[model samples]
Target: MYDRPYPGNLYIHEILNGHDVRAYNYFRMPAQVFTGLRDLLADRGVLRDTRFM
Candidate 1:
């Protein structure tokens, strides 16, 4: 079902790297905080990176 060449993570990355307001509009949280939370989850094994993800 995942057909987009950019994929979700890449799109998120782009949003995070772009304007802070865009990230907030998309995630409802600041980019830095969101990134920190994501990293924490991944480091704690709460998030996993899959081929399709």
Candidate 2:
């Protein structure tokens, strides 16, 4: 995945040239929310390994 900065937000993409992307209002996002999502993804095998940065 990769991130790109915009005027007042950021976008994260799961693929470089595909449609799997999401826009983040980063300044308003809570860290726990991200962690929870990561954990869910790992549990469901959506992520290859249970690893996150």
Candidate 3:
């Protein structure tokens, strides 16, 4: 059989983009809050996006 089409990041993107309730249900935080935290960490050099990530 062929591999599944959607990758992990795409799935995450769907969840984050879909609805506030979905993001909250999965992460226990609203989408805005989660994205804010991610941005903060990236600014602090605490998180980096790599090709694999």
Candidate 2 RMSD to the correct structure: 10.5
> What would the per-residue lDDT of candidate 2 be over residues 1-53, giving only the tens digit for each residue?
23344321223322222332232343244455565787799899896642332
- Per-residue lDDT, model 2, residue 24, is 30
Give a tens-digit lDDT track for model 1, residues 3-53: 658878787778899999999998999999998998999999999888876
Name the runs in model 1 displaced over 4 angstroms.
1-5
TM for every model, in the order presented, reads 0.76, 0.39, 0.83
By TM-score, the best candidate is 3
The worst-scoring run of ten residues by lDDT in candidate 1 lies at 1-10
Please write out the lDDT profile of model 3 over residues 1-53, one tens digit for every residue. 12548887777888899889988999999999999999999999999997756
Q: How many residue pairs clash in each candidate?
A: 0, 0, 0
TM-score of 1: 0.76
Badly placed stretches (over 4 Å) of model 2 are 1-28, 50-53
Comparison by TM-score, 1 against 3, better one = 3
